[model samples]
Target: MCNTVKVSPRKLDPEIRTALVDIAARLLAEHGAQALSTRKIAAEAGTSTMAVYTYFGSMSGLVRAMVHEGFARLERQFARVRQTDDPVADMLVLGHAYRHNAKANSHLYAVMFGGQSLAGFSLTEEDRQYGRYTLLTVVGCVTRCIEAGRFRTGDPLLIAHQMWIATHGLVNLELGGYLIDPVDADRCYDTLLSSLIVGVGDDTKASAASMRASRRRRRREVEAEPESVAHRS
Candidate 1:
């Protein structure tokens, strides 16, 4: 069983659902999840509370709607990245999107990952499957780089986690006020990762070309993840 919110996308009038979702997204950003009640939503939407119920059925419904909507937006971000023929370059692009999206919506990111709700909700397969494509797209690009001998060989998810940890740090530091002075966050991240990519191999590596070939060989050896990697949560 799951708790829901009012004005859920499914429950809303087709004409007004888009407005309802926009209101909820803004409210989530400005006021956090606790403020997402029918009273507040209806008031903000210039409607009666009864109208919200007529649209969303219950509060639990609205929450599910919001979660799904969040994932949909995330998917759109990744979709904009050009799938370069060069896998390493694509991986870098994926890294950039990861940090950018999280920073753009820190509060929502916190709630999505931190699970701050008073009433817990269990996502159905359809809901949970949302936005997963973004991560898998990265994994897929990494898989290509591995096959190309450009990146280290390991479990794709493990490699994906490493990228995640490094990229997530950008947001963590930005939130902590680490980028207030001389450091340009984007520059630091690109430089730091370049150094890391260079260091991941050894002195025995004959040249950049050889190292890339080695990476390809290793990726060829590693197994691919299940198709379900698309889910974000």
Candidate 2:
């Protein structure tokens, strides 16, 4: 007869789970994806290796969760941009939110976009589907722009994709330090956004005005952030 001992695991703790993910994201950000390991993540998170297995099943799973979290944070930022009378301005704000999320979570950005680090797990069709949901918000904004005649009538999804491509290229470059300083990046971004808006059928002058409105609104939102946090506290 073989004797078997069933070892019971501790109840999964949400705090610990979040900590592990956060630690892994920071490591990925600081040292790139190859730096991630279960033992290293567990040590930094102050939990045992088993905790990672318990919470995320494996290192790949943890990385996958991190990618999802990145998208979730991006969506949250998108949610903050309230729709206004100007769809063009609103769309630009959403683009700014996308860039903000990327810079704020620089570690997870590459992973979310299929970094070389997804060694064990391949993103399934479902994962791709989940990621595309973020674009829907952009599409909706594009649709509004079309309806408002701020943009030429075209496929909203295609327009959104073009916008995303332009925006992501600029942001990825900025994050990689291609653009010298914040001031330079901002200038480049404004230039790129203005060109994109014009390319999509808006007049150059109107595009410039919309960009100014977007900047002013973003500044107001930035100013309100501290008060918003204090109120929550």
Best by lDDT: 2
Q: Compose the digit string of candidate 2's lDDT tens values, residues 78-174.
A: 8788889888998888888888878876877877887434647678777776679999999999999999998999999999999999999988898
State the displacement of the C-alpha of residue 125, model 1, in Å, after optimal TM-score superposition: 6.7
Question: What is the Cα-based TM-score of model 2?
Answer: 0.87
All candidates: TM-score: 0.67, 0.87
1-233: candidate 1 lDDT, tens digit per residue: 01133353345465365455556656776776677777777666666677655665666666666666566555655555566565665565555566655655454455454332623655666665664555687678768777777666767766776776777777688766778788887578766555545544312333344335433433222222225433222
Query: Which sections of candidate 1 miss by over 4 Å?
Result: 1-15, 105-107, 116-128, 175-180, 199-233
After TM-score superposition, what is the CA distance of residue 46 in candidate 2 from its true location, in Å?
1.2
